[model samples]
Target: MRIAVISDIHGNVKALKAVLDDLAHQAPDAIVNLGDCVSGPLWPEETAVLLRDLGWPTVCGNHDRVVAAGNVPQDNRTDSFTEAALSAESLDWLRRLKPAIRFSDEIFLCHGTPRNDDAYLTEVIDGRGSARTADEADILHRLDGEKAGLICCGHSHLPRVTHLPASGQTVLNPGSVGLQAYSDATPTPHVMANHSPHARYALIEEIKGTWTFILRAIDYDWQSAAQTAAANSRPDWAHALATGRMQDGA
Candidate 1:
């Protein structure tokens, strides 16, 4: 079976459409969305409706939870922005999303780690402004008792494929579908950037019990997305969406 995975699309419908257009060319048996679907300064309602119609198997992310609760935390206003934009139906759908999906005994899907939706499944923060891969042992420890042969997760927005030789498990992070660069101060202040305005995702193929995956970062017209962000009083989002760079003045 071949599966295409997408994640972290924090509302930019332009990016979402670009991803869907790309998927149409690389058709797979199934598509799975790892959430954070609509919670940003971009087109939250439109993106939510699009995903609702697409009907891909999905799981909730941290932002989804905040939207469901209709409460913005201290640092981010995504919850409020999304709450105002999303319709009742869209909110209900996002609220009802499952935390995880076990496609089979061997395949599993989640927003972040199985145990923590906000946890970084595969990333380690190195300092005040960067994120990197965790140590192998650390990865294994965070993964803990997860025994799925193929584990798919997101939340960090960095595309990566890791094959753990110790447990014969392969983990794939398909990357962010919409927002490419973001600065988060959740656990600490840090930034993530793909360095280009690209729509990103991945494909996983299970052939004869062997799992192989590929990450794709495809270019898209992000100027429109940036315009929306700027209109929403979020020039930081505009700069990040347009350039995928974290500059102070953007």
Candidate 2:
């Protein structure tokens, strides 16, 4: 079976469009969207409607939680005043999303950790050195311990896969389609501006007894998207989109 894993789409309709267009060639069995679908630069209403049309399996995220609460964070302001607005319907969709999903004995999905919807698994926090149990640590820790063969997730906005020799689990994070936090180059125009703005995603293929996790990055019309953000009144978010960085590194 083949599956595409995607997450952290924070609006940026152009990136999502480019990714979908590219994925058409692969024709995977199904696509799994790991929430945070519409909460950034582009129009959340448009982004949410489009993702709903895709009809992919999904999970909820922290940004979705904020949208649901209908109250933006007070101190955690990342974007300038211009770029943090969201539509009412968009917030409604986010509030209704689920947190985690399980698939078969070998596959599980979540926006963050199984324990909490808002917990993030970055290299620093969940690295091998900090992990405790085999299945309960980070993604790699859980994958190795569960021996479920494969586990996919998102939230770090960093695309990566780790193989644990101790328990034989392969953990994968497909990164963000809208905002990428960890990159080869730090985005500079916003935060990691030097980084490239290629929408990233993942393709999981189980052939025979072997499983392959493929990371993909595709080019989108980020310039136009940024321009749109500037026009819409959220220049900070728009700049982050073009630079591939988040306002608060979330």
Candidate 3:
């Protein structure tokens, strides 16, 4: 069977529409959305409604919980769009979301870490990778041996595919559909329209006895998404939408 794995769709309806249209041709058996479904420059309510209508199984993202709670700290407000999206209704949905979901004997879905539901599995930074090495590895190891054959997680907003040979598990992050946020030595990668937008997702195909995880990036109308951010009085948000940079080079 084939499953389309999507994650971190942060309220960019335009990009989501493009992705849905593109994936339709592939004709997957199911589409599973790993969370961070709302809280962005665009209309989050519209995005939530669309996802609900599509019957996508979703988990709670960190920001999605903030929206559902309507309790974002004033200092963390990156843009006006962020401020506007925090509402009671959004919080309600987020509160209702399950932290982890088991798809089958082989597949599992989650927003953050399997150990702690609220953990943010950020990539290693500085020498911290060495000191914190065992922390990351241990969780992955446990998940591999006991949880499911394939473990998928969102929330880092970075795209990656890795195989845990010891545990016999494959872990994947499809990145962010709305915001890419893959910063390294470079400021950010500017993807042209011809290139599939910075927007990325994954396609899981089980052919024969093998499981393949293919990470796909698609280019969409980022400018329009930026415009939507600006119209919502979120210029910084628009800038972030166009550029894949994250806060503090995250």
Question: Best-fitting candidate, measured by lDDT?
Answer: 1
Residues 209-246, candidate 3, lDDT per residue (tens digit)? 78988888787888888888788777756766776543
Across residues 103-213, which tens digit of lDDT does each residue of candidate 1 receive? 889988998898889989778887656888877788788877889988899999899998888888888999899988888876678888989889899998877868878
- CA lDDT of every candidate: 0.87, 0.68, 0.69
Shift of residue 92 alpha carbon in model 2, Å: 3.7
Model 1 TM-score? Answer: 0.96
Q: How far is candidate 1 from the true structure (C-alpha RMSD, Å)?
A: 1.5
Off by over 4 Å in 1: 73-75
Error of 1 at 19 (Å): 1.1
TM-scores of all candidate predictions against the true structure: 0.96, 0.78, 0.81
Instruction: Please give the distance, in angstroms, between residue 8's alpha carbon in candidate 2 and its true position after superposition.
Output: 0.7
What's the TM for model 3? 0.81
Kindly report which residue pairs in candidate 1 clash with one another: none
Which candidate ranks first by TM-score, i.e. highest? 1
| Model 2: worst 10 consecutive residues (lDDT sum) | 183-192
- Per-residue lDDT, model 2, residue 229, is 74
Candidate 2's error at 98, in angstroms?
A: 1.2
* Model 2 Cα lDDT, one tens digit per residue, 104-213: 68887877665555554434432322222223345444333344566677766778786766567667889889875422221112122215667889999988978888
